[model samples]
Target chain A: MPEVADPEPLPVPLARAGDPAAWDALFRRYQLPLYVFVFELVRDESASLDLVQETFLAAVKHLGTLRDNAKFGSWLFGIAHQKCRQRWRQRTEVLFDEIPESAGEWEPGPDDLLIRREEEAGFMNLVAQLPPPQRAALLLHYVEEFSLEEIARITEAQLGTVKSRLHYAKRALRKLLEAKNENPA
Target chain B: MKTPRELLLARHRAAEPKLDALRREVVAAELNNQATREQSFKVSLVTSLLCCSNKLWRELVWPCRRTWAALAAVWVVLALVHLAQRDGSPPALAQSAPTAGMILTFRDQQEILNELFADRSVPAEVVRPGIYAPKPRTETVALLAA
Candidate 1:
């Protein structure tokens, strides 16, 4: 990515050397986008936060394993993606939704709560309806704006596979939206 | 109605403003815990080696530390066992080993022949031919003097 998103990106060396500020800076740079991507997959904000924490911890721990420091964003996303896959494979008996909710640090307040809730619910419902892999590709591409190569790396799929996933996802979403218009849900 | 792509982008963009607070928290939490979570000794060694020119060597010896540790443990156990076995056993006897020599046994030739031929008709004793036998120490000294 261009330096525009991060004017002074944390050096990979400093992070690899276990520099606290570097790790903090790295976490700050990617946490929101990564959380949104994970929350989209798991459909639980709490679990999304856990997965984000897990991803950053893992990235910080295994920073040396990363080949290109510049692609840290994609690599970190890949770790989060793996965590989501693991959560899917080993689901606990308790419904994540049934769990008591914690007070999040950020509340929408009286102003944005109702509108944000509706938009978030609507967008999430649409995205969730797509096949998991396709939805992941779409989110990584459109929402996070990862390059095609980066998405392919994060998804651990062939470049062509990434393209096809995005292709099928957009087509499926468009079709669903058209049907929704016809039915006026 | 807006297109689906537009809706996705719009939602993503709007969501971030609210999430920035949570992101800040995540950063703070990670930074606070950083000191306690340095890479382990083995991992740090592997990490250093991996950053070297022989990165391929790093893969080959990825489990080197653990393997070396196991081997050292086994060696120490074996050394301890050997020491215990040595201490537990009695010391070797101080007596000397038997000497080498030749001796002869003279028997009745006719009786010997009859016994060889009577194997089927009667139970015959089997005898082994030997020249040397261990004698008492006194006899040994007397024979040596002779």
Candidate 2:
């Protein structure tokens, strides 16, 4: 994939001062990205829209908690991630961390080409099938192109846990691809 | 062949246009929320100031009205007493300047006394110095012996 350019810096101080134009500029910049991240995780259009709005509103209310303005993107994603977690918690009693780690068994090489254009739909299907934690880690790491530390901060996971989840998720995806390729059904 | 990141981004790109309406709605909501919060803050501040002023009046000023009136009455009485005393007293003259009549009276009394004493043939209204007046010789000798 071609590298995406860095977006214009957000007007964090103006937004903090409750300027409508500043908040609008911020929403315009992050609304789509935040929606995509949330929609991909939840797979519900309405929920994704609501989550995006909620994330913005949450940003408005607790903007003072953000210590750095340069980190606005990750911080906004972090709020969406937490909102998704809340929804998940309400729907189920299952714990996200208890999912077993298969990362130990699979050591994917640096040059491994795990995805292809033809397998795009299959790849997303398998990704959606992944557990919430692993899927979140993968999307944040690959799709959002956040650093491993940024992913950890966004997901509120440990650095090692983020690494492990990314490793395990990719390994699982590769296995799914291999299985599909072998069967050819 | 596209990478997973590229494929995912393309897939989600379909939904971007649909979010324009949502953007307008969210921005409107945020602006409205901010306006409401600012209005409430202003109201609360004004209410607090009004409450503070009312509390000051109730606690400090209204209850002490009797004491304030009594203080005013005392001041008025002191002022009246001072004015009455000032009105009754004689106006003072400068002590260094005496009137012509007072100087003339003083000089006349001194002259009369001096004249009476100087002429010993007239009975001296001023008592003559007894030691200088001639005493009888026998009385003087007897006085000396005593």
Q: Which candidate gets the maximum TM-score versus the true structure?
A: 2
Name the regions of candidate 2 deviating beyond 4 angstroms.
Answer: A1-3, A105-118, A178-185, B33-42, B60-146
Query: What's the lDDT for residue A10 in model 1?
Result: 57
Q: On a 0 to 1 DockQ scale, where is model 2?
A: 0.32
Worst 10 residues of 2 chain B by lDDT: B88-97
**Residues A17-63 of candidate 2: C-alpha lDDT, one tens digit per residue:** 88888988887777766777898888998888888878888888889
The CAPRI category of model 2 is acceptable
Please give the distance, in angstroms, between residue B62's alpha carbon in candidate 1 and its true position after superposition: 41
- What would the per-residue lDDT of candidate 1 be over residues B30-146, giving only the tens digit for each residue? 666664455466677887777874765566566597887898899999999889978875645534443343112234566678888885744344454566878999998998999
Give a tens-digit lDDT track for model 2, residues B45-110.
999999999999899878998998899999999999889877885545633588899999999999
Query: Against the true structure, whose DockQ is highest?
Result: 2
Can you give the DockQ of every candidate in the order shown? 0.10, 0.32
TM-score of chain A, predicted model 1, versus the true chain A, to 2 decimals = 0.75
Which 10 residues in a row give candidate 1 chain A its minimum summed lDDT?
A: A106-115
